[model samples]
Target: MKLSVVDTERCIGCQSCMFACSRLMGKAGLSRTCIRVRSAGGMERGFVVIVCRACEDPPCAKVCPSGALKAKKGKGVRVDLTKCIGCGNCQDACTIGAIFWDDEADKPMICIHCGYCIKYCPHGVLELAKLEAGHAKR
Candidate 1:
């Protein structure tokens, strides 16, 4: 699977995706949201949508000292909270800066690629794409 940036120009920077993620996890506030939306430069320069790209070999999982992260092919990695030691290696390994943090829990927040945030993206800036066979490295 793929989560594509349909059009960054259309983004309104409303932070709807962040709220959607929190809501999907049955929570309130953005402290634990997986997706992040921030201004590119300033309000007039538009915004940037930060989320997981579902890498073939997710470095996040590779750097997990506790084996808490599991890469699921093109679906992104699953975080086993029980196995997670609240280490920050996975967060640093993500080149795209998709990994988020929960200050209260001291654990990294990651996207499950559930597409929950897509519906709330009013500008149509994001869309999930299907990955072809062999699209990801084995």
Candidate 2:
């Protein structure tokens, strides 16, 4: 499966993804969202939806010393808080600024590609795609 960002031109900077991410973690606010949509230098440039692209070889996973980040089967990565040392290595390794920080937990928040936020995206900015049976060499 691939978690891809669709056309971002329609994004209105509503930040629904942020809320959805936080909600998935049972948070009532945006304090714990793995994804974040912030204004591009004052909102005139539109919005940028920040989230994991589920790279084939994720750099975040490589830099994580505590093994808090692990790739999931046919999907993105999941965080094991018990193993997280909060060294911020994953955050530094993320080139797209996808890994968000949970200040309270002192750990980086990441997308698991659950597709829950896709419903909240009114602009069709996000999508989850399933790979064909023989697409990737096993």
Candidate 3:
């Protein structure tokens, strides 16, 4: 399953999803979250929820010189932390800026599509969808 922003219009910019993601990492702040929600301009303009779309052929994984980021079929990339060299190549390769940095560890934080954050969204803005067989988005 992959996390989807089901209804961005329903989002109130409460950032519950972000908090939930961080909590999963046993942290008390936003620094550890793989997901981010920010205002497009201001609260009046709505917000943007940014997370990995689970690319079929993720550019981030392709650019990893250390083989830390491995592409997962029909999902996304998985990070082998021990192999990561803190090169920031994955962040540069992601066009959507979904890749988040852990400044303390100097490593990339990526979503595993665990759907833990979806339950915390008060507006039902997020969902975990099953990938259709043989379906691909370029």
Best by TM-score: 3
TM-score, ranked from best to worst: 3, 1, 2
| lDDT (C-alpha) at residue 77 in model 3 | 86
Candidate 1: give the clashing pairs. Answer: none
The TM-score of candidate 2 is 0.87
TM-score of each: 0.92, 0.87, 0.94
lDDT value for candidate 1? Answer: 0.85
Q: Please give, for residues 28-133, the per-residue lDDT of candidate 2 as tens digits.
A: 8889887878777778888777778776667888899988899765566788999999999999998888888889879888888888888998888888887435
- Which ranges of candidate 2 are over 4 A from the true structure? 131-138
Higher-lDDT candidate of 1 and 3: 3
Model 1 per-residue lDDT tens digits across residues 92-117: 98998999988888988888878879
User: Once model 3 is optimally superposed onto the true structure by TM-score, how far is the C-alpha of residue 60 displaced, in angstroms?
Assistant: 0.4
Q: Rate the local accuracy (lDDT) of all candidates.
A: 0.85, 0.80, 0.89
Against the true structure, what is every candidate's RMSD? 2.3, 3.3, 1.6
